[model samples]
Target: MDPTDAFFTQTVVGAPFTVLLGRRRQPGGSQAEGLHINLATGESRLSQLWQEWALLSHATPPGTARTRPGRVRRLMERHALWVAVLGLLSLTGSAVSWGLLLWK
Candidate 1:
């Protein structure tokens, strides 16, 4: 299998499990153990485990499948284009500031 494909699968499936399980173990052990366990389980099983855990953790009452985003998220979603424009403008401003600083 392609290295990229393997990495992407690991990122999507194994990473979350590693993160979740990592919190429970001693700090040094967590990182090593998480990777070892996740890799040993392989992608499919890790994906299933992640999905099951996600569903359990994020469980909402039945029939409430679609919930509205929070205020900040909704604002961002609705004004994504504007946000991008503002971000670009801020970046330009910072670059100009840096140029002026270096020129001095």
Candidate 2:
């Protein structure tokens, strides 16, 4: 599916039962779990996600000014992995540097 295209499904299922104290087996015989899926998407993705979400009063117009991501967010989005392996390696190196100073 394209990033712009969206598909939604909502399922409703429930089994109503009551429990009593000192119950070895279930009081009732059995209950069937009935579920159904329905699409909640409207005419367009913008209507369902953006407009209903109140992100904007209306659909985004052409050339709407959007705030640029900060330096840290940009770094995480580009070339870098989300896990931040470099951060862990740096922490290890810093610990070793501290150990060397103490060893002197």
List TM-scores for all candidates, in order. 0.42, 0.28
Error of 1 at 79 (Å): 1.2
Off by over 4 Å in 2: 1-72
Residues 1-104 of candidate 2 have per-residue lDDT tens digits of: 45233222112323434532212236663542222234674332332332343554465564888778899888778957645788888999999999999999
Clashing pairs in 1: none
For every candidate in turn, the CA RMSD to the true structure comes to 17.9, 20.6
- Alpha-carbon shift of residue 58 in model 2 (angstroms): 18
Residue 37 of model 2 has an lDDT of 32
Error of 2 at 37 (Å): 38
Which segments of model 1 are wrong by more than 4 Å? 1-47, 50-56, 59-66
Alpha-carbon local distance difference test for all models: 0.66, 0.54
Q: Write the per-residue lDDT of candidate 1 for residues 1-104, one digit (tens) a residue.
A: 79998899888877433245223433565322212244665653334445565667656755777777799998999999999999999999999999999999
Candidate 2 achieves a global lDDT of 0.54
Error of 2 at 63 (Å): 16
